[model samples]
Target: MTVNEPTNHQDLAEAPAATGEVADLLAMLAKQRHFLRFTTRDLTDEQAGLVPTASELCLGGLIKHVASVERGWAAFILEGPSSMPDFTKMTEADFARRADEFKMLPGETLAGVLAEYADVARRTDELVAKLPDLSVSHPLPKAPWFEAGAQWSARRVLMHIVAETAQHAGHADIIRESLDGAKSMG
Candidate 1:
């Protein structure tokens, strides 16, 4: 979609109706994705990788990170936490490799990242739509921030994904503005 395209809410109204909790979750996700898409629109690979802010976050990196996070969470919803990568035991080199997933590293392009983000979103929507129970719970992976024996419902997972995407979308907005004085939203 173009930067001047209608807002996500407006576009969603024209699409098929999404029912219940899935609808709500998808709406929020779509709004965040909208902003993320807007921020990256018309950007070159070089511009996407530019670190214009105090933070290490770049527009393209934010895109890639959000996509990867969403995909992982979706997998967790489908196949439990064991389906996720073990970040706790990652070596220094592993951490470095993971960090590259956020940056527009060699052979990475804005178009490629955006395409992957779209594919992940589509898969997530399909999974959520077909889920029989939003209340199905999965144990969270071992992490310093996670409480021991903690588990999250599928609904909760979807909410977390929405929150994560929205947070990064905001980061992308700031990075985009810093790069070229273009605002994702007023």
Candidate 2:
């Protein structure tokens, strides 16, 4: 099927019904998540971990990183920036641990990472639906990347999640093409 085809295999994984802006946001997120997930289709654990490009990102690593990012941002919606690590104060060890999120360390299976991603996605969808107000926001935590005194509503955070997922899905597409001939998009 072409990219324009509705209900392709990649998009078969979907959340329940939502409406209006919430529906629009969730739909975009699911599409990107599916594209990222699609890149790993039929890949072996070793293949998933192989970095075929100059970039360190492997298909499985991309999955792990995206899932970690989404989970943290989803928590931020409810718990605010405090739910995230203090990126400013992280030590070398902490930095190293964060980097490991991109690797399929020994015994880490493709199936396992994908399963974790699915769980995280489900929880994020549920959180968005149950939240009373998308306008509710929190001050961004101190970080080099985040602007000072900036606050983001739940809706804004969700948009960030969608952007992150799409960016990484593009990375995953490249990685997958390098690993094999498969393409998530034509």
Candidate 3:
């Protein structure tokens, strides 16, 4: 879809009618995704990539980062710990290359990032719907930020996703305002 096209979040509106934790999670996810897309509406690629503040983040970069993060978490939920890439094992060059996932690099358009974010949202919703148990647990990936031997239930993961998305959506809003004084929400 074009950057100007409204996102198809009809499912979010119907979420309350659907029973269970998954529906609630999907609703929250949808809300954040909506806000994120709203911030990017009418933006050009150059405008999207503009670093309007002292921070490294830009609108398109935030979009790209959220998509990649959600995709990774969805894979972790579906495929278990083996799905996570071992960051500590990566070479400095590998880290540098992966860091590009967060930025709107040359030739990367805002439309492309929005499309990717939409795809990841669709996949996450599907996964949540099909999951038999929200209480199902998986070992957290080995990371400096995570406690040793920590594990999280699927429900917790969904919550984490919502929190991450909402946090970035806020960041996107601040960046957009700095760009042209346009606010994502009143």
Candidate 4:
């Protein structure tokens, strides 16, 4: 949901009220990252790789995917004029060939991806902290997920990242449990 700015100086002067909108979003993103970390802990390479179906989305792959998403969105938040990363640039064979995919690459391992996410989260947190005004607008990307002609604030984008990460965190938990008997995230 989009948060509207308060109209007057009196409303703007309220400290507690101003915090409620952005702080919740920041917290949510942190919580989701924590949960996702817990879910991915203590699994074998084979278990991480297993998909359980023909769906092409394994536990490890989800971690990779989310990290990429985080970076892409972070870039969007930082530089609104550029397009997000192109997944089509890398094929399945190419992904397999990446040194990182061999656990020697930057974003290959489950642990590595989580580590990268922590960095991304920190950067995103800094962005949220430095936002000049709650009403500052950024263009929301064209996607089936969000409504069209909708202008978003720094607060809204921060919350959207939190929501997106949280949703994927839940998925990661299930995928992790399915791979092994580890059931703590439930």
Each model's C-alpha lDDT?
Answer: 0.81, 0.87, 0.81, 0.58
Residue 149, model 4: Cα distance from true site in angstroms: 3.1
> What TM-score does prediction 3 earn?
0.90
Report how far residue 62 has shifted in candidate 2, in Å. Answer: 0.6
Q: Which residue pairs in model 3 clash with each other?
A: none
Candidate 4: worst 10 consecutive residues by lDDT? 6-15
Q: Write the per-residue lDDT of candidate 4 for residues 85-177, one digit (tens) a residue.
A: 334455677656542331323335555555565666666667666676656776666555556756676666666677767877777667766
Candidate 4's C-alpha runs over 4 A off are: 1-20, 83-107, 142-147
Q: Is candidate 2 or candidate 4 better by lDDT?
A: 2
Please give the lDDT score for candidate 3.
0.81
Leading candidate by TM-score: 2
TM-score of each: 0.90, 0.93, 0.90, 0.68
- Candidate 3 wrong stretches, greater than 4 Å: 1-17
Instruction: Say which candidate scores most in lDDT.
Output: 2
Residues 47-102, model 3: lDDT tens digits: 98999899988888888888888888888888877898886687888888677866
Candidate 2 local distance difference test against the native: 0.87
Answer with 3 or 4, whichever has the higher TM-score: 3
Question: On residues 76-173, what C-alpha lDDT tens digit does candidate 1 reach at each position?
Answer: 99889789867689799988977887789988887788778878888888888788889999999988888989999999999999899888888888
lDDT of 2 by residue, 68-182 (tens): 9999999899999889998899999999988898888999998888889988998899889777789999999999999999999999999999999999999988998998887
Location of the lowest summed lDDT over 10 successive residues in candidate 2: 4-13
